[model samples]
Target: MVSIAIIGRPNVGKSTLFNRLVGKRLALVDDQPGVTRDRRPGEGRLMDLSFEIVDTAGLENAHSESLSGRMREQTEEAIRIADLSLFMVDVKSGITPEDQDFAEVARRAGGKIVLVANKAEARDSDIGYLDAYALGLGDPVAISAEHGEGMGDLRDALVEALGIEVFDRDAVASDEAIVDVPVPEDDDTPLPYDETKPLRMAIVGRPNAGKSTLVNRMLGEERMLTGPEAGITRDSISVEWEWRGRHFKIFDTAGLRRKARVQEKLEKLSVADALRALKFAEVVVIVLDVTIPFERQDLTIVDLIAREGRAPVIAFNKWDIAEDRQELAKELREKTERLLPQVRGIRTVMISGETGEGLDRLMKAVVDTHRTWNSRVTTAKLNQWLERTIAHHPPPAVSGRRVTIKFMTQVKTRPPTFMLSTTRPEAIGASYSRYIINGLRDSFDLKGVPIRLGLRKPRNPYAAKKKRSS
Candidate 1:
């Protein structure tokens, strides 16, 4: 792949430009300088030109063993491997001595460099843009990474530095190349069990519970920012990946906290984004620290997933450090059974995010749960089962009248929603509802999936006619 790296002194808008090019906030960005201390790589696209981009730590001069010096080594390494580098500078701050130092480093690295003067949205930045010429790199492309200004000039600079033919933006938009190909007609046939369709899964849990670490392990790379600090992730980022030839799209969501404890405005937004990810996901893996297995918030998160009609897999993470494996497993199983009985028989997998242990089993459980979530029960089989189930332990009487469930039909799948037509639907007790739902789970082998059971009294035609006459 064509390789490019972003290298600059501390707080020069390098991370912001990196995010702008990579199309997401994959790197952590804060007003605090030196937020990024590692080299992060991602696939990036500029219009139609695709390349691998690396976001490096802010460059600075320090003792080799020091943190800032270590960060500088990472940036130098990125420059060494890259075919081109975007040497970014903060125009508002002008060319500091550090900027000149990194510029000299970039020049000696022997890679094509594009000088990017960021924060040029303000008129006052003109002097800094001129100061960039003293570095003797090249004419600086002045732009604002935050406001997305002067991208055309930046694109032109990148094209020239990469030594590529000028890209025809209009040609990229036109469909002329595929005009001769016949369009396939749409058929009303239902799709068969196809693995080509991307499996949509979301990883979620409480803050500092190794949610991001587990995601990075599954991806086989550090795609998300992870540190000892809580709430490092603020946005829900979906990454596409393939395993064993099966395509999958996994969402790495921000850690969820109790609503009452969530006081920060940014934390509230992050929680909202995480919830949105859960709703869009077909299967959710609730990451729990084995030592602190089931906090009240973890159960709440699982309940939310169940109520949203999505399948759930309880992943006990950090298993490598847990004290007693057998005891912890028993406790976790018992807690899952007692607490999340609504999503009865949810699959639980033990994993270690650091050691990469039990990942295959976790993935297998995920795939299996997704299959169960999309399962369908035949109408005849459902009704037959319902008859036998009701016969064994009939619905209890309410005010001297027993509720009679006449029929049941599956309304949908993907969480397996069903509608039961019944006499005295309003009289159905919560206990009886749980009994029927448990029966459905047991009979259909629909483990690890949330089942939605709805009661409906058959629409009364006479009532509608009576109302019209009145």
Candidate 2:
């Protein structure tokens, strides 16, 4: 695929243009200068053309060891690797000294450059558009990345610069490649498992918890840069691989510290990126150091996974170093239950990231948890179980009248959510709800996944008649 890099001075709408092409908010965008410190790469689409697009930090002159200098290095590396560079300048701001300097640098980089005069929608930008010719990068493609104006001209320019055939204008405008599948006639029948859709899983934990190491072990290669230093990973990077003929997409996320300690701007962005991965994932593996496993931060991460409704599997890393394995396992189980009662019976596995021991068992646990997370129960079976459960231990009374559960149905699954209709639904307290949830978990074998039970008041048949009379 053709790789393109968006290179420009600070706040010229380069990141905005990158987001526009990628069709998603993959990079952080803000009004402030230098919001993007790292070079982020994503798949981009322009009309019918598909390619890889990289968003780089704004170019600036700084000391080699300074933060801005590191950003400059990252930008230069991106430019060096890209087949084409989109040298952007804020036409509204006109041609500045910084723009002139970077223009020369981009010219020396020796790649096909297409000058983009962003924010050209304004009438005042006419002079700046003419001034862009002084950079000697050919005719500038006037555009407004924010408002999405002049995209057709930009597409034409890219096609010309890349030396590709003219794209069919009528082709569908989709950011990703799509494959057609036959639709099922029956709505009740679940779709078959799609091996093409990669199972997305995220490995997350506190700093120095061997997240990167575990990723390397799983891939059977040192794909991730690992070290003894803490916070080595600054962004959530995803790697695609296959395990046992099943395609998988795993994300290795930045180690999260407590909110009070995370004061740095870049660290905050990294944490936000990790959370995006967590929400995107189908299953989350919380990797913990066996020696210091049950930290408050670990519990906090587990709570986050549960609240996000993603299936979770706890992996005690570095288990090979422990002395009393059996005793430690018993203590771990007890602590997990006591600490995370919200998600009881979550699957846990002990593994060594260094030696690759117990990885098979860990994968088994992950696959099982994912299956249970997606498991659904039919309404007939659900109502039957609900009836039997309520008969065994009926809902207690609040004040003078007793609460009555009329009917129940399974709404959906993927960490199953259910709806219950009852008389005076608000009368059911949290303890009773817990009892019903526990009953559902035990009866349907829906263990090791989060379950959501919502209550609804019974419909009033006479309310409509009363409204009609009024």
Residue 452, model 2: lDDT of: 90
| lDDT of candidates 1 onward, in order | 0.81, 0.84
How far is each candidate from the true structure, as Cα RMSD in Å? 5.9, 5.8
Looking at model 1, residue 253 earns an lDDT score of 82
**Residue pairs whose backbone atoms clash in candidate 2:** none
- Put down candidate 1 lDDT per residue, 278-300, tens digits, no spaces: 88788899999888878999999
Q: State the local distance difference test value for candidate 2.
A: 0.84
lDDT of 1: 0.81
RMSD of 1: 5.9
Q: How many collisions per candidate?
A: 0, 0
Range of the 10 consecutive residues with the lowest summed lDDT in candidate 2: 177-186
